[model samples]
Target: MEQVAVIGAGSWGTALAMVLANNQHNVNVWSHREDQVNEINHHHTNSKYLPDVKLPSNLVANADIQEAVENAKAILLVVPTKAIREVCRKLRPFINTNQTLIHASKGIEPETHKRISEMIEDELGEGVHDQLVVLSGPSHAEEVALKQPTTVTVSSYHLKSAEIAQDLFMNEHFRVYTNEDVVGVEIGGALKNIIALGAGISDGLGYGDNAKAALITRGLAEIARLGTQLNANPLTFAGLTGVGDLIVTCTSQHSRNWRAGNMLGRGYVLQDVLDQMGMVVEGVRTTKAAYQLSQKLNIPMPITEGLYELLFDEKDPKHVVDDLMNRGKTKELEDLSSFL
Candidate 1:
């Protein structure tokens, strides 16, 4: 069995640790909170994140970052987008060659506009390029913790690394697929959260499934536009990490981005929604980054732009919706016609 270190003790990280432990791998879950570490070790529970879910006994917790990564064969970087650099810097000292690096976190870095993999490369310059893998798709931590069936994709510049990650996480209930389209996978995964927030806002505004379905459809188009502009394979957007992830995040109550957006639609201020959720809603931060990126890249992302206004510009949600509906019409396939 392999020794895997999950660098964050958040819901996703803990659930992944459980997956590793269930695969008979020894897992060390690292958290900055001493209480959280204690709870995982002594009580086998992370109540704050995954209520009523029992973690695997073999899955241990560590407050010491050094101890967690010192001997691990693989490391799962599952922290939020903002904390990736800090965590990678913390891991730099203990890392050596021939180690697998997998990042399950989703979101583009706000200021740098970098994908999670890019952030990792910047932080861990050496001994990471050959082993970097991105894990993403429709899977949720809560359901995965319950051992429910979930499918996901792992992508990498190095095909071997992607296949290795697939083996590490694949099981009867947790199916893993491998892809070489790292750009498409990362872009699709990150951008979908923004659309999910829009979906939440639509629901909160008392809009029905028709509205959300349109958001999901058009959101995929926007994501494909940006992703292809960034040199990703367009077909990847039709796969698991693309349309698959979009549907789940936009519809599921498990999505913090969607929940936060819902609150905003219900007339709660941005700060109030963030305060109530008490979690890092990646889409909120991602919207601003995406808005900036779209401008810089000369890509049209109307949905992201609208969400940016609603979230940061203090624009009314209804106005944003109205504006979206009233925008000039164009052939739906104009942007993606080249791919077809």
Candidate 2:
């Protein structure tokens, strides 16, 4: 059995641990909270995160950081995007360069606007990212914890690392695929939440599927436009992490982005929507980062600009929607020329 260390005890971390434990691997899940650690080891449940789902008895949580990291063959990181750098700093002193890092977080850093793998590379620069891989897609923690059917994509700069991740998580109920486009996978996974929030807002405004469909289609275009400039493969945005994640986040009841957007569409302020989310509303921060990056990169991202205005500048949602629909007419695939 492979001994793996998961560096967070949040819902996603726990769900992934369950996936490993079910495969009979020795999984060590680390948590900052003492009570969460106690609950996972003693009660076999992470009530605060995954309620009512019974975890495998063998999977457990560790409160000590060193104990969790020691001798682990592979490391699975599931912390929030904002905490990635700090977590890396903590892990740096303990990491053996050979240990592969499989990151499952989905959000960009606010100030650096860096993707999770970039943050990992920054934290441990010079070939550290060669051993890094990203696991992303539409699998929600709530459903995955129950062993529900979920499909995800694993990306690595190295094809071998991607293959390792594909073998690590793919199962009867959980299907996993490999992609060499780490940039595309990371970018697609990070930005879809921004669109999901917009989708939620559209739903909150009671707009029909026609609007939602248009938002997703156009959102993918804008995502590709910005991502291509950052060296991400254009087709990665067309696959599961790109289109698949977009479908789930923008449509599912399990999406925090959609929930927050619904509140925003109902006329709630950004702070209020965030305050009510309780969990991290990643889209809010992504919107800010993407908006700033688009300006810096000189990429024309009208949807991101509109979402930013609506979320922070008190722009009317209707007006934002109108502004988007009234933009200068262009061909369907003209924006994709950068990829060619």
| Cα RMSD, each candidate | 1.0, 1.4
**TM-score of candidate 1 versus the correct structure, residues matched by position:** 0.98
Q: Mark the regions of model 2 whose C-alpha exceeds 4 Å error after superposition.
A: 336-340
Model 1 regions lying over 4 Å from their true place: none
Candidate achieving the largest lDDT: 1
Q: Count the backbone clashes (under 3 Å) in each candidate.
A: 0, 0
Colliding pairs, model 2? none
Q: Which window of ten consecutive residues has the lowest lDDT sum in model 2?
A: 331-340
Q: What's the residue-level lDDT of 87 in candidate 1?
A: 90
